[model samples]
Target: MTRLGYQVPNFTYPGVGSDGLFEAVAAQAVEAEESGFDTVLVMDHFYQLPMLGAPDNAMIECYTLLAALSQRTSRVRLSALVTGNTYRHPSLLAKTVTALDVVSGGRAQLGIGAGWFELEHDSLGFEFGTFTERFEKLEEALRIVIPMLRGERPSLEGTWYSVHEAINSPAPVGRIPVMIGGGGEKKTLRMVAQYADESNIICAPDEIPRKLAALDEHCERLGRDRSEITVTYQTSAVIAPTKEQAQAELDAAVAAIPELAARAGGVILGSPDEVRPIYERILASGVDGVTVNLPANGHVPGRVALLGETLAPVVNRS
Candidate 1:
């Protein structure tokens, strides 16, 4: 499980042009690995998320970036924060992650969720189905994907996806951890209890308790121990040398992307000492770990290192 994961969700840096963008990203990954972070994740989206910036903002393909990061850093596990199930077939998705695992020397984790971002789906010609339909597709995809990852040949005849004794050759270097992301109590948590090695709860700190309880109920109902699966919380942060500096950075971020302010209440913003207590409070809520994104200044050269230093002790203490 990733006790402290650093997510690189923003690709547009202030002065680093497109030519130097990848080097900038790789630097952050290296810094994260050198620091205390155990894993590095990227968002699986085609366009810049609406809340982050305009659609045209720099957004690279997820797996390609992860595969590249594998060569730059030797320790940190590589994965998309959560792959959208609607983008590719189950068999292909499994094969892709398996290849990544092989190349990364067995440090690969699969994080998946029901596809969202209706704009991307429509624009890219993927099926933009209703919420229920998307979940149905995700469940079917998992049924096929899980077996394939375990080196089993699974054949399924389902509405959304079907495979005939699909083979996953050159199996993963090791057991690829499966992480299901979302906080839906009924369907998502139920699936997580049934098939995932980890459950990433995408919510604020105040909601962690309820999400954990819901996951527990599902695990109990399925005759599974809640402890069998690791639980990780996902949120954003803004860190600097002092509280005022962090606030100023956050204010500038909100000014550039107005939509960010709407979710500002949930973002953790402060210096190392100021935010440690907040992370401690979240850990006290029963989450096994946390994966935070520094949306405001993560692309800056030493920011991820600072974040890793600040949060590693708090997370390791738990």
Candidate 2:
């Protein structure tokens, strides 16, 4: 069956931008669990925007939030939508995730991607390499991380990172799924075919079919089944009771995110009945899961509840 998931924003800069930070997240996690959402995902970004209050707002750290969140919600799975490779050493990352898995009782999944957003790197003074260099770093980091988690002591020297005898203790007692982020067909998908347990593609629903074909090609090249990697997405949305309410919500969301709105047109602005077909179309693209972007603040908790309780029920899977 196609799995359904939800993503809390990477930036806390929702409208009326208070550093509500993750204080609201704990509540949403509970709501998601009760509503039957399968996975509760959070985006990884270190900086706060103007609307989010300040450049360095009252944001909570991801690992800390995850720890607290694990305690708050019993059933739902938790993960970063994707962690940045540049933020921590691969060894440290693997170690941290191992701990999270242990505490969460095997409920942790690690999603990582090449780091972008030059502002965070520059402001924090972490090395902000070129895009190509970041991708290279991610490859080596994944290599170092996965093996260490499996109790293999791997030694590696790469352009960006090197580890020798980096021991990850109390190895992930479960599969500890690793999801590579991005739909960069040439580079990212190739990495997923060889490395990741999952990969994410962000596009309009119509664009997913072509990307899936490319992923299939990558799978063939790796002599692996495309089914081996779970395909997921970050799609726009709006859930309201009536056509007028949906339109009003969409209008508010667009005003809040003029750029994102212009880039994507309207979000999934409709009632559950109106929106179910959009999800069905997504499944037709061979997607096994989806992580709907909680693009707005006021609406997100309610929308997440609706998705778990309503939309997920009608999605047909074979």
Top TM-score: which candidate number?
1
lDDT of 2 by residue, 173-232 (tens): 687888888989899989989998888888666778888888889899889877778888
Poorly placed runs, candidate 1 (over 4 Å): none
How many residue pairs clash (N, CA or C atoms closer than 3 angstroms) in each of the candidate models, in the order given? 0, 0
Per residue, candidate 1 scores C-alpha lDDT tens digits across 200-313 of 888757888899989999999999988889999997998988999888888887787676777677689899998888999988999989999988888766878999998998
Query: Residue 249 deviation, candidate 2, in Å?
Result: 3.8
